[model samples]
Target chain A: MEKKNTQQEIEEEIKSKGKDNIIKKIFSWILKNVKFLLIPASRLEELSIRQIEYEKKISKRKFIRRMKSTLTIFGMLLIFFIVTIAVFAPWFSPYTFDVLVGIAPGNYDPPSPAHLLGQGRLGRDILGRIIYGARASLTIALPSILFSLIFGVIFGVIAGFYGGWADSIIMRIMDILLAFPGLILAMVFIAMWGQHMEYIMLAYGIIGVPYYSRLIRSSVVQSRDLPYVQAAKVTGAGNWRIMFKHILPNCIQPVIISFTFDIGGIILSLAGLAFLGFSDPQLIEWGNDIADARLHLYEAPWGAFWPGFMILLAVLGFMLLGDGLRDALDPRLRNIYGAKKKKRKKGKKEENDSYEKK
Target chain B: MTLIEEKTEDSDRDPEVILSVRNLRTYYPVLGGLFRRKIAEVKAVDGVTFNLYNKETLGLVGESGCGKTTIGNTILNLVSAKSGEIYYKGVRIDNNFTNDLRKKIQMVFQDPDASLNPRWKIVNIIGEPLRILERMKKTREIRKRVLELLETVSMKMEHLDRYPHEFSGGQKQRIIIARALACNPEIIILDEPTSALDVSVQAQILNLLKDLQRKFNLSLLFITHDLSVVQHVADRIAVMYLGKFVETGTIEEVFYNPTHPYTRALLSARPTFDPTTKTSRVILEGDVPSPINPPSGCPFHPRCPKYLEQGKSMACSEDVPKKIHLGGEHYIWCNQTK
Candidate 1:
């Protein structure tokens, strides 16, 4: 049976792509040959789905066992609302992000049907600016966090896998970077390079590296000694394969959990930097809206209020989502809320099944 | 320091030595405080010497810290030897041996769950060695070889798509052994391969290992603390204590006519199946001493029964004992034998 299976596999693999373009043929061939790489990844995805199902079952039995708790539901709705506004901002508002509405610059308008949420000090539509502001905040925070995570994991894996002099040097550099407060260091980078959206993002990305690297390093140190890694070494794998293939995959869980929380924090800080004029003045961000309303504090309090409210809502949604992820991912907290007796019986049944299968 | 003469089972056949070690020592430094000063040293595998012959299973039995695992790791060069010489088929392997040697010497770790990569499917985990050492490219060929190996370990082809976590401990161990046998290695170091397994499954794995070894003529360095388990699988036994080999002999010599006091204690500790036989348990006086600051002269002298029986003589504390041959390959490190 095994022989026939292998024969069928070989035949399928060797099948030709008829009359295709040279590039198309090459792409198909590359894709076919890369089956070895794809199978493991697909299997990994399948295993992770099993893991998520297991976690869902555990978390359901424990605290707030519902598939979607009230808090999670609210958070999801808020995120959905924000994303909708960002995606269809033009449809929601009569004016563009920077264009004036109701009146010219240096004028303020209160809530009205034609221009809801009133007008900014520049007479631009507050609702439109707020919608576009969500786009800007999300784009900056997500990419910067991604940049930091990629670089952090690389440095951390290298430092953790090849200890001794390499670990010492990499950790020492991280220490020096960590010594300065992240926000202040980001401000320093903004000061060095003229203040712009990209520079602010670059600064945030640089500052985020040490935090993630340190997090990844600690986890890596614990996992590097696991017998699987030792087994990989015994198989004659080099340092690169051991670090990337074996160690990095296991170190990603805690990093992902931290990344969720860090995204909220980065959004808050990005708004703060813009408020402090570290970002380009021309960019229509929530922080820029609040900064513009500073002179009209008493006359147009609603100008700052709308933008401030959106920032609060966005940060709260992310924080709630982060908390939910932590609860789901952490095993100790996983089995806390459902009927203890029922869950224990189920667990016992599963254990027996595993035993019987063996 | 005169070397003890080693005897093979069939001396007339000009027995081939697959692996040999000379004065092997591995010490770890203990760093203290800021500036990282060398505060102390851990003599994990201090001055161990032995040889493994072709197609023979050499069991290394010892207590937890006696460095049995360390010796196994050192042989595979996983843990670097501080000062020693290792020869594989009379070819010296130092820090810079060619990668092909890795295919010749594979290892099966103790804990099956920890040994197999949890994120990987059975195919990748087992085919990894073939990919690295043999540089086999085609996925079909790798999959076919993986299936054959799994079958050798008594697993089916359907298991190829499953992840490590999906399998039971015994099945995971089968995958690990399959991985070790992937390159068709000449020698495999089974480092307590069955310690973490259930009693029934342990037997199954041992039998599988024996069958594969016989089929491939593979030499095995079986390291374990359980004497009974090793007895079933090992052809020769080396009794270790406090990071040194105290007794070396064939299974019959070690079990029937045990030489070293440590060996006797280890044997007595094994619970006999026939409980009505009424055998006296030779429990030692104290624990195995710390390897950091071992006893002067003889490392085992502090806990040695013979030393206590002889009134703790000054000679036992002052001088190291020489290796004394009993019969065949049996040798003991004791002053009485000398």
Candidate 2:
């Protein structure tokens, strides 16, 4: 019985030693592979620290304070109201934009309780058509402007960054585009492609490319020879990396300001084209409504007045926003908009202290 | 006299040559007329030759527009050399520098504000070299290396996220230095690195550069117009005049026994601190001649005081003088030197 007990104790000790070996092997594997996971984790922590620092230094709180100005606030509210009206047009509008409700004299009725913004000559509800027009106007303007911005930046960066032969070829093409009057060129494009909404937007988008390209090109030319560019070159950076990475970011501020302002201009152009019967007459656009109401203006003025006022409000909203962005983005003017001046002073004091310590 | 002899003998002993520029000439085309033709050529770096030894600082002192910066630029192939051969580690590199050679040689530009990209954070600016040359794709590894470089330059990790505009001029310069050192270059051409800083800041930068040189065993081509700064840091001095080396020597040889007339004029222009001893200043007459049409023979003949003292010798204007060796490594390109 005593020998059996001693044998059991030896087996248990051997079993425990094997378990210890397995544990050691697992720990060794983890020690070797854990850094890959830990590195990314540390990177995430560093990124958060960077974000926090950025917030402390260039606080969005200051941007909010600057945006509190009356003009910008008014612009934001106008845009907000227009977007809401467009989104809920099916629910909020009193009647279908196209269905007729009356005949003859009753169709051209002035502002009344049943028809709040009155009825059109075709007997469609004017308020409903105007509310729906916001959707059409935005769909055309936003896409067209975005298309122009993307293509224009590509052409401009290629021209300015490469210079020499590439510059000459691209710039000459842009010059040829600029030579023709914008509206006339757009009209010619629409005439060839047919008067559908998509074609009109495409024409407008093509017309805007040269203006943005030229603006970006001139600024890029000025910044291409800065000392930072030379520094990058010395570090073995290729031409593409220098052009897109270094030169583009520094010169993008002016492009952004121009981008905001160009949206307003494109919307006006789209309206002008619609008003001239360049679009399909069935489309319920603001300019199309204005055109149909012109003949009945003497009888029911609200028909012409409402659509024109909506157009004005859209354009004014974008223009005010552009002006506010210019004030915010320009570093020289940023201090006037409640940015903390004390940070710069502290930096200077630290510089002085370092100098003394040395 | 024996100490001076020993110094000359020490310089004569052959040191390793890391870079040698032979008869380098760089010209900039001047465009004019309606068709924008090349009307003339500005001789920016005209027929300059020198050898840079390993682990030494060669101070290049010249007035503004005398082509000191042009020489540095030409060596880095930033500008094409019209006629010359530049050998680095015994391999020809003019206009044919490989990516490896480019990694080995770097530059610190004069204006700190201009050298750094305003839009980039400090980490990206310094990490640029490590990314391109070292091919460090992992952000964690790059951040770690950049942190190490920043520490070498006495900057902290907290500065990694800030833009160039937020930093002071001295801080910007330190960041630029840190960027230059990221690739572990053997030679660094510093173009007036401290000229843009205040006097106290200048001293700090100079000392930092000295410490970095000792630590890295770097060969520095220090280009500046500040005589006192050069005197403090340079192992050897090369005095340039009108895109040419007028004199070259060990610092002791050039400082105490200047042979070239141009060298004498430049040294006398340095401000002395002692109030008791009155030293005569050699104020050079006339402005630096136009590089587009530099004067024949010696470029400095028109303003050379020694030329006037020698009663306007015909040799000064008619013929270019050859290099005259004054024992050891001391040499001057002046007919009146011997």
Candidate 3:
């Protein structure tokens, strides 16, 4: 019986045109209907679709409690301010971290005008170092975390899909890499590679790989089992296509969350390495400033406070963002929120069935 | 005296068959780490074969884990088969031809939520394969075709750009059907497509599937655990048990005068709407045995009501009964057939 359908399928294929035409048709429709294409334009004008996808739905009263538990407006603004300062450090601070702009190479008196946070051990402007350090820390952490995500996602994808000898080999390597504590491993690699910005990034990437690999690997395992993956396979999508197209999209949740934490961790680890006297002093980073200010902290407490405050804000911001994302993207949490504004109406038949059943 | 008299079996059905399987087997081995020792093999589909003729819906009905799903998956090569020869268009199907052969075949999965990728907009979900395999017209053409497909499936043109989450469960399934129809496939193997839906949604999807099948003249390999569903769709029925088919015949023959012992028990289990002729609700005692170490004789002999040993089936539980052909194409694998 399966034979006859093949004839009909062939005939239809021959008559109307090939699959390419069908695909073209869909694309054209989107182009023509571009106005509605943006969330509201489509036929799915159901109330749920109109809502911003990741917003958390909570009881109106309970909503206040949720916001209360997370970072407040002041904290968020502080984080944003710190990030902006770091991004615009060149414009914000006329002096580089090491550039002792003005103290006339003499009078390192009490906190006063001109030098806002005063000078440190090398008589470098403390304000200059703190602002420059934000730039230094962000560049280092963002790039380092990015490398980690890239290699980790690649390794994780391979391990999750193959699941046999290849999986064993890759996982064992991750286990070996994971044996050393993340900070210790980063320190060792930085020491071996010799301390350049690139070397530090390399160190952070290597050390962070195992965490993302394990995370993405687990996500891939779950995603591979979703019926859509199997459906893709039955429809003749190859292994690579299935891995990238079907399985990989679902793994984005954890990878995104880990990226937030990786940035924070990278900042701490890089600073810790710098404080341990590994970082080149010429770099004039957050950690180096903290180290320089340690001796005269009581006298020039401003030196310690600015650098410490900036570090706290950057780390806290990424974390809060990640926490907000976790609550929104996690399926269980989204279901709880159920978009309170509107409920979908049942079709006539469905309404009638319920009516009859009632 | 046979429930079905001898005269009617031999006269129906054509001699020519479209696709036929001999001894099909698909066993998934449960394993552990490192050395990867095979702990136990779940014989999801074991030693099953039946011919599928053209232009007919063959309902492969059985309880869950009875291997009806495995049979469909194996046929489509979704799950790797331990040993099976799936022929397509008189050609033996291996992994190589499986890709090209897929255009002719498609499957609608059980869960609409799990089956449709949430990230992909409706257009990509339907138009992706057109970009992959077939060489076709411009982007404008494919877009129009998709809208036409949406219209054909009773969906609006406006739904093209939205994501899967925007639609209701029924709409999701309709989009899934639109996607399946995109390849313009000849055979659609619906694996419990309606089971995950509400009754009202279920009726609509079923009706849509029927309408599409008739309109397009598509062949369907409808795999379902629900016996009531296949009645309207399948022209023929193949009742599966523990990875093997116990009965294969016309729908009328299987439902009206079910010959195989297991088939009869299953039929007996479905409550009759007729208030006058009551069914006893004969429960098949005990859980389905693990596929690893199945019973010695007939797999269903432990639960068979009409079974007799002759020392061949139940006695020493040694010799297994072969599939007995009782005229026409009404075949049954049971010791009592003789």
Candidate 4:
């Protein structure tokens, strides 16, 4: 009767409060009732599972913090600088990329105070062209990669989730696309359609679809039979709902990681396409600048060097960031870097102690 | 007053039969060798038949691979039935593709952890069926119902915001139970609901289930290999062997006086708590035969104690035994009957 009375009293008290207050009271009550003395076995198991999750989250944060590798940092800075220069192109460059503004003829000049990266054969400012070229490279890479990702993920998830004739037919089509070398296929696409920014991006995105689709397909296949997927089906969730809601979230991590690296690869491919004269001649692009300076490669080395250097820097930055992301994302691999850092810290502490003793 | 006694007023009164299954067979093609050809068919649930009364828990007890879970899933239409007739409230729903059956019947899986979506909050997890089937559109209405369900399973309303991983196995099961009850289901198929839980937690969940069953007046199809777990809760028990029901009866009829040799063997295998009473455990010789190629005559004849005792009679090996009724709902499938 006393137990019943107290319970009734608590319920009445809880009811008196608003919903938020009731939630607070309930939380407090639970915290009070969690018996530490007699820890249940299931509770212990739950604690360990929670512990593993907590450790994973903490390790992930720590991994991300420690992921600032020298090359990754350098790459990030380079990308950041390039993007900044691209955004403020007019302010950063002294002269327009197309206009001949140099004091020398043949439009090619050696290094001077008035012009920073010397001058191209066309007399267009090399530094200005490179700054403006960053815009073209980034615009082509980011949007095309996003386009490919969206299409790839959709096709792959659908194909993998609904395996059978769908799987075989879709995979065979992708295989046909994959059979052609990426650059060669891009060239073929350029030939069929007139070479333009849109055409190049479409060609690049089309070729990229096969690779991402295959990656996402394998992941979807693995996660498709995970018990939660079956649970969702049992709950009467539609096939599309199950594919998007249940399976996609679980299988997208590795795909996202690979996507970063693919960005760098896409940038390189775009540059190659531009170098092959696929882009508009009026556009101030890195590969086009490099191609323009090719005739004067021996006469003035500075013309080719600047644009080529920028391309290398951009690619290296993207690749390094991708590598760092890979190391940071996976806990097991992250631990290797973590262990080395911890060892270095320990060694430094030991040296400090010896110095104090001396 | 105790919840059990409070509800026992109508214990003797016969409840209406809510769901019935007749000769349900679920088979899977066993592909083998390099070419992935269909070598043979494994009859997982071969011709199993039973009736579940309203507010009654019919325990389907069996060995590991004896098709108890398969039977439950087949009834729920999770696995396509090879052949059978299933009636829910007298409607022939043999091959149902609609959501009406899902609304009527909800199932709780064996593994609580696996059964729940790890990424989803308790509200969405439990509210999914309500929104999908019941069309409970308003968030306020859904929240109210979800809270009521949580309370029904002895969980707090605050638990609504939490994920499945945040709770213990017992608590996760309570959430699953809450989800099962969200639709106000007529029948809840518990597929080894307590097998994955701790022994103490198992008792709590069982008690919770019993209370919920009585409160909602819902029928239960409890599937489990562990006989003792169902012994207390089930009004009637069915013992299965090699994809077939060897024996079935009321709890007392099955527990106290099991007629089938397989049932007797199963009963003996259940460890006793009493030190005083002695029971020579019925150790049946040889492993349970594969379901792909079940014995020609009686499935249990090869491992039957009576068959060996009666000098391996030709009747035991050559002829199939019809169900022999030993008075008042107690039926056994065997050649020799006392």
Where model 4 places Cα greater than 4 Å from the true spot, the runs are A1-88, A100-112, A117-123, A277-279, A287-358, B1-15, B33-35, B275-277
Q: Which candidate has the top score in DockQ? A: 1
For candidate 3, the per-residue lDDT at B111 reads: 90
lDDT of 1 by residue, A5-108 (tens): 67776666567534456999788788865765666655345444335445444445443453255566677778788888877877876786557323455467
Give the Cα error of residue A290 in candidate 1, in Å: 3.8
Off by more than 4 A, model 2: A1-55, A58-108, A294-301, A316-358, B1-15
Off by over 4 Å in 1: A1-93, A97-108, A291-358, B1-15, B311-315
TM-score of chain A of each: 0.67, 0.70, 0.67, 0.68
- With candidate 2 superimposed using the best TM-score fit, by how many Å does residue B262's alpha carbon deviate from the native? 0.4
The most accurate candidate by TM-score is 2
**DockQ, in order, for the candidates?**
0.49, 0.43, 0.28, 0.23
Error of 3 at B243 (Å): 1.2
lDDT per residue for candidate 3 within A1-358, as digits (tens), equals 1455677887987776755577789988888778666657353343342232212221212334333434544446666887888888878885754365333453333555766777666566777778878778888888878887889888999999888788889999999988877667667776787777887777777878888889999889778788888877766677898888878876778787778766766776776787777777667577666666777777778777777777777777777766655554432333333454234323433543454343
- lDDT accuracy of residue B300 in candidate 1: 78
Q: Cα deviation of B28 in candidate 2 (Å)?
A: 0.5
Clashing pairs in 4: none
Using DockQ, rank the candidates from best to worst.
1, 2, 3, 4
Docking class of 2: acceptable
